[model samples]
Target: MNDSLQVIPLRHVDAERMMELISALVSSAGSGQAQGGNNQLKVIADTSSDRLLVKGSPEMIAKVQEMVNQLDTTPTRRLSGLRVFRLKYASAGHIADMLRGLLANQSINSAGATSTLESASLNDASSTGAAINNAASDSLGSSAAAVSTSSTSGTSTGVGGRPFSIIADETQNAVIVNAAPELMFEIEDAVNQLDSRRAQVLIQAAIVEVSGDDATQLGVQWALGNANSGYGVVNFNNVGASATTLAAAALAGTSTAGISAAASSIAGALIGIGDSRKDSQGNTEFYGAILQALDSSTSANLLSMPSILTLDNEKASILVGQNVPFVTGSFTTSGNNSNNPFQTIDRQDIGINLNVIPHIGDNGTVRLEVSQEVSSVVPGSTGNASGLITNKSLINTTILADDQQTIALGGLMRDNTTTRQQKVPGLGNVPIIGRLFRSDNDSTQKSNLIIFLQPTILRDGGAVASVTERKFNQMRVLQLVIDKNGTIKQLPLSGTEGWSGNVSADYELMPLNPLIPKRDQAPKSTSQGFTRVDSPNSGITTYPLNR
Candidate 1:
């Protein structure tokens, strides 16, 4: 075996795949030379630098070097400077369209124009035009030879008296630009700017049922919460209590600024809401903490906590329910042999659906268009026989709020009433006394629906990582029941300490948004709702959420 090593640099061939083939051959060579001695060849590939490191006998090393040269064949290249730009975030089709528009809008210089970075030439366009005309003429003529077409389409005249063509590859999200070298430089720059990652928004939506005194406290503005009204909220943007009620138009979603004038009305009455308002201990707190305190009681019933992540200016939708099938229309087909009834059944989702499109503003605020609908299938109604009877509450509103600030939506009210009667079997036939044998009962119930929305802007990777870690810690605790509630043991996740379920009390409450302000630490709280509870690092238990 040779004591020294040999280096083989490759250009055209891929180092990783070549290494696999070489390794197999080296193993075979070692097996063949087992009786002789340790002639084992070691092949190491450095994919980054496209080089191979090998240590073997002189004869084996020379043979391997020869194989490398033979396989590393130089491929042909295009005479034209054509390039394909792979985009990470932007759509290739959209970018190509934008480039075409830009190039088309470019003004041509009449005074013996020398093609510059931003400018293109009209003279260069004639060449591409001639090519197109030639292809057309060839196809029209009677010839045996095939008339080939160019993939490049002349979007507009480009730099250096040449016409450039842009083609978008949707499957690979890449844009292929064929143009003069000068124009290619400018095109690359534009693509780089557009291909960068856009900002993302994390929307957390909580739907709760408000009742008791809480419902009364939220009056007109509360109802306006679900639907957009002429009036906005009174206590807007989680600020301290103020007198004049702000109109909903104040935060109406628009490209420009919101309405400054608002008619005076008392909107916010409930106290201790918003992140700006501190708790009893004077610690910065999230309004969700106050809601959690109410969640334990019948005052507030948390219907759902649905969250989604979406790109800026992109729409995100969430549907938390089931699809129900109902007959839409039916037709009977008559034939001499047999008759059959055909029914057209359509399925509709009966649950909570919240759609939101968030636009991240430069001023640390987010404009959102929220469309929320909550519906259920009604029972024992006239429409229920043929089609499904549905009770639905839908609201579509556009509003602007501060970053990480909770937007309150309420005002949807529902009333349910029921009457039941119990009667005797046979003895109840005795006229007036029969009434005494039967018992009657009546009941009426009312509930209000309120939605809370909070949007967090993720500007970079750090913010994403922080949120990821926070969510991981907040996962529900798991328990291992070796049997049916017998010999139970707690399960623990690897890499994570025994701590489970006490996700981030402060992290969840504090703003994770980098664009907005946040608290240094979570406010001190006596309520165990936000308080951290020490639990053994038991195994994870996946339990089905109760309906």
Candidate 2:
């Protein structure tokens, strides 16, 4: 009748097992009195909170406490919960595949205390099979991640002992893993590291056309500077090279070599090739060399400025031109003898194009695979024209440089000559005697294509925010200048109060600034802390329990 109730919270051991063990001990240690069964120690397992409610005499409760203390160590049981890791930047499927490759060779020890593997064999990942419960798959909270049943073999894999399974929830953008708790922590750590936001690269480029004389000047300026690495190579591409073929060749560490690069009427001759960077001595070069040389009599003109922003290890491209239709093929059907010919028309893009793929290094260096082209339809080329006259300038190369470094590509030139003679109508037909009244004019001009490129890296969210804010504010300023409304100057651009020196969850789904529209994305209260999530997007969203 005189028993005390003790509530004990557990971290490792399951509450049910703990109670069973203590019940036996209490029964044998209790005094042999004529008390009813109700007098015995009552131990109830609280699996909901992983706690134990124990009622017994003071002495019995003391024993139970001692036993609980002895058993409450870190659990080594080789069973991991179905843990879901929501990814931010990295793809969930990619991360899951990487982890599976890492854990493919893991084996169970003789004692079965832990999962052991020196290294995982990637070859086995494709062939390995696993078994997951259908109920567990169907019960997965996120509808985006519908679980696989027992028939789904590759979702879980094991050589022996308890199987380890990993599934990628593409809709949820999450990686779900079921493994030992000890192994789970290691996998979770890797997920956290891999799921981080990727760095971004912004590339700026300018294409210029200069006279042949200025091209020589630029070539000299480009070659004169001593490279810090002291390693350099020059490449020349053949005329009329396709963009796809040129890029493939460059990626394979080779060049298009079927035809020799002779006097190209289509693509101009290459004038200069070199890296252009600011020197410690502060000598104005690069653009200065091109413009100053053009300032004299070189007749240099900037054609276009193309800029693109992209993630690391990704490709960015910009193209400015017109699409001209050309006949690719002509077909005649035998069934129709009506002299009717069917023609296939293809639209060819003719203009300036710049494409680059950037691979970032940890040392603030970037390796760029660049492909540039300038193509134009000759003065009077039309649809379905045969052997149409076209001009083109193409360059494909890879360069490695420090972040925010500039490089110059030039020397592509085209040559054209014109001869005009004006003569008296009847007198010009008089052969030799007409020469006295006839005037002859002959002129030749040369144009060289020059390209300058610069790549900059944005390492963190703060850096991204700063760059984005600059662009946003620039537009805002432009808007203010054009607006005639009285509130133009008073319009608030102060929505950036979210960003700080340290950016953690600084970017939100809905704008904090009152100017932008806000959605009702806040979580609704439920019996389960956050059992229901109402988000249109697949990415992770944070919700406070109190709300």
Candidate 3:
């Protein structure tokens, strides 16, 4: 349907009516008088100039013809179409200048690069390096050049008489250091640093910036064959890969209570504190887990996963006992029962779950800053306790770039032991001799310490006095962007897309409004044509379906 139409100004036509007419004309023409007959329509217009170009078929021509007849008596109105916006940056040229200035002010290269090569060599052109060293040494003080070899056995000419040459083999590449060895090393090191820096930049760009094919490849690489790593619980008793016994492992130790317990821990880890992700005390929650659901081989695979925060052998065993679906194996003990009473531990499955805490964004997307709360229960034992102490003080640690950085609002908790003591006194008796004789075992603290990462809106505590619960609730959602340098920045996503840009599915934009209804996420698809059937009993004619 490629029919064209030309029209003159009309006294009766208005912009709205003209648009409607054009739409009808285009639709009628494009249908090719085939699919439901004559329903084709496609038009392009220049919005600002009120210029219109219409294209379609015979029926569309007839429709436009009717519109032209009406327009002959009406006033022509301006046409509106797809808008082409010319974005004008407020400080376009100045942005570059400003960035350069900032870079200069920060002395961009001053931060010594982090990674380096273990050992390396550089190309040497002239024998200037050898000559310079000779010039400094007494042996060749007045000589034009000097001879040297990487290996002690190789011979070299003395000073000025001959053009001194150095011999090197595959084992080592010699640098004719016209300067001191120290200076030569320094130059080589610098070159290596540059190479490492370039590689790092390329990797970061590939993983973080580019989307589509490159981003998918990076994600696949990150996950790799981790799914089939056979780490979960697939290898108990060396079950055959295709054995029917292997399939039975899923239900081996599964019980409603067991699954519920695991789900609880996962839920807790995911839910953050309070109205926002922050807890009552205002901190971002982070969770970790160690799975024991699989055999040693499978355990190793599970640990290899990037999501793992920690993975001890004991934890893996517990996970196995619980019978998580992803893992499969015989839930029976096969090892010696005398040494390890838990030999039945193999047959009698167990599991350890890491809370599924929401990960706060690290980049400049999060508008809030939070102090995390970490719980530790020493489980008052007669012997010394070994547990991590977090949130007591900040420590230096590096987070790898491949890890997840999504903000979540949940957590999980699981109890592995049932042993309990009613009371214990003098739990901290002096030294070895006191411990043996101490029977006052009342109120000995027991149980695991669960540390949750918390998020907070206040950058500094001073604003806490002015903050109301309503305001806090209003700021619950957050967006963040993180760079490889470990710099965390908060970017408020309350407005249009914020740091996430125009991509709709990448992130969920939730505004903290108590009164508004919760957002619905349903798939949207194109609708089919309208129906037209009247009441059979009445036999009354109805109007045609126009839209």
Choose 1 or 3, whichever is better by TM-score.
1
Over 261-282, each residue of candidate 1 has an lDDT whose tens digit, in order, gives 3322223323223222334654
Task: Give a tens-digit lDDT track for model 3, residues 154-268.
Answer: 2233332221221122222222222223123232343243322110000000001111110000000000011123222211111112112222322234333532343243211
In each prediction, how many residue pairs overlap at the backbone (N, C-alpha, C within less than 3 A)? 19, 14, 95
Tens digit of lDDT per residue, candidate 2, span 123-195?
Answer: 3343322222221211112232222224434333233233456666666677767865535655777898888
lDDT values for all models: 0.55, 0.56, 0.27
**Runs in model 3 lying further than 4 Å from the true structure:** 1-395, 401-443, 450-547
Q: TM-scores for all candidates? A: 0.46, 0.48, 0.14
For model 1 the local lDDT of residue 409 reads 64
Clash count, predicted structure 2: 14
Better of 2 and 3 by lDDT: 2
lDDT score for residue 258 of model 3: 37
Candidate 1 at 126: error in angstroms? 31
